[model samples]
Target chain A: MTLVKVYVNYKKSILNPEAQAIHSALNRLGYSNISDVKLGKYFEITVDDDSKDIDSEINEICDKLLANVNMESYRYEIVEGANA
Target chain B: MTLVKVYVNYKKSILNPEAQAIHSALNRLGYSNISDVKLGKYFEITVDDDSKDIDSEINEICDKLLANVNMESYRYEIVEGANA
Candidate 1:
């Protein structure tokens, strides 16, 4: 099986409220030096060994259901010989 | 600033229905080689430079909020001189 790891984050042009809230909370908790506290999602997908073109196949899956193309940007890396 | 990345995954002892559903979907979509598709959460936290003991501080935060020790296993990495 191929392990495909996807990292999804808000587009650079968009402002994320959850990230802002975390930033504020960090400051309040005495982390004044922290900045750009962006929050994002991560997915670890295990693709079948039978896949012919694993790279493109994973990309297609990400575009279809894993990522919100409108406001979010995503990237993935494939690791060979992984179970999950 | 320090960038802390926490990867949370379900314990091996538990059964993850979401992962199973994804596995089934992949098979239906013709990915019969796939197996052991596990689902998990990821967190990227930006901590202030003012932190004295970054390692311990990040661990404290993860134990308190980022990870639920009951059913999830988590690991983190600390990157120095990063914003997020």
Candidate 2:
């Protein structure tokens, strides 16, 4: 079995409302030193080892349905011999 | 500086299409056995260490901006004296 982990996040240059809200809250809470608040996301997938096309599958998913390539960036890794 | 690491992901029970694509990819890659694929996200925020009220700030951010609370799940940890 192959274990794949994906991490997705807003582009660094893009404006994130969530981070801004967090910044505002932190400022109000007297933790004003918080410079920047960025939001990120992740995913862990377990796949059957019988197929050897995980990368293409992941690419298609990212391109078609999983993420908005224009706004979010993602990376993933496949683990070998893990939980096999 | 306080390092706050947040991990946001689809609730464990949610259906993840990204993972499914990867699952198919693995099967094509010749290393099948993967059962499911899930997508997740992360955020690493740096807050001013001088403030003792980071918890509230984080909470508000999570509720109002950082996470949807309705579909995604998130968690964060704040470090003390690590980068001071």
Candidate 3:
């Protein structure tokens, strides 16, 4: 099987209130050295070894489901032997 | 500045309904080649370069605020030159 690690995050132009809240909370907790905090979703997908055109398939999946293309962007890496 | 990438995920024994839902949705979408799916949180924290003991500080931050240690586990990597 192939283990695909996908990271979906907001675009730079978008304002992420949750991330801002986390940053404020961190500062309140005394982590003043932290300059910024950004939050996103991560996915570990296990695909059958027989998949042809895996890259295209992954892109399609990300566009169709994993990420909000209008406000978010995504990137993925394929790990050949990692456990799902 | 240092960019810390933190990945927080449920422990293997924990039930992840969101992941299950995504998996089932994929199957319904005719992507049967996908065997499994796991979902998690990803954080990008940018910290000032002046901080000493970054590793310890990061661990403390994760334990205190970023993760629910009882149900989730987290790992982080320090990327030296990545833009926050």
Candidate 4:
């Protein structure tokens, strides 16, 4: 099997309220130097190693469902082994 | 500065419906070979380098607010630079 690790996060140009809240919380917790506390989604997908067009398929899935193209961006890396 | 990367995910013993839904969607999209699609949260926290007890502080923040201990587990790593 192949392990596809995907990380999806809000675009840098966009405003993320959840991230702001977390940043504020960090400050309140006496971590004044803490900054850029962004939040994102991570997915660990396991797939058959023999599949053809795996890269494109992963791109399609991520673009169509895993991430919002306008506000969020996604990237993925494939690992040779599977721990799924 | 210190960059704390935290990954929070549902316990392996628990059922995650969101992950299942995404898996089904992947199958419908002709990725029948895809399996073990698990979802999780990724946080990129930027903090000061001079702080003492950084490890325990990160643990406190993660445990108290970043993760739901009953259903999820969290792990973190600290990088040596700043990208906040």
**Model 4 / residue A51 / CA error / Å:** 1.1
The digit string of per-residue lDDT tens for model 1 on B1-84 reads 678887888888978898788778877877666665667776777766777887887776667666688888888888877744
**Candidate 2 lDDT score at position B70:** 84
- For model 4, residues A1-84, the per-residue Cα lDDT tens digits are 899999999999999999899899879977786766989999999988778888998999988999999999999999977666
lDDT of 2 by residue, A10-55 (tens): 8877888876876787678655677867766676766666655779
lDDT by residue (tens digit), candidate 1, A1-84: 788888888888999898788777767876566565666777787766777898887777767766689998888888988755
Which interface RMSD values do the candidates have, in the order shown? 2.4, 3.4, 0.6, 1.0
Q: Locate the minimum summed-lDDT window of 10 residues in model 1 chain A.
A: A30-39
Q: Where does candidate 1 stray beyond 4 Å?
A: A28-33
Model 3 whole-model lDDT (C-alpha atoms): 0.96
Q: List the candidate 3 regions with Cα displacement exceeding 4 Å.
A: none
lDDT (Cα, 0-100) at A71 in candidate 1: 92
Fnat of each prediction, in sequence? 0.62, 0.92, 0.90, 0.86
Over B1-84, each residue of candidate 2 has an lDDT whose tens digit, in order, gives 778887777776777787577567756754345476665657777876666688877777666666788888888888765562
| Candidate 2 ranges with C-alpha deviation above 4 Å | B1-3, B9-34, B39-41, B49-84
Ranking by lDDT: 3, 4, 1, 2
User: What is the DockQ score of candidate 2, to 2 decimals?
Assistant: 0.50
Q: Find the candidate with the highest lDDT and give its number.
A: 3
State the lDDT of candidate 3 residue by residue for A2-74, as single tens digits: 9999999999999999999999999999989999999999999999988989999999999999999999999
For each candidate, what's the DockQ? 0.56, 0.50, 0.91, 0.83
Ranking by DockQ: 3, 4, 1, 2
After best superposition, candidate 2 residue B72: deviation in angstroms? 8.4
DockQ of candidate 3 against the true complex? 0.91
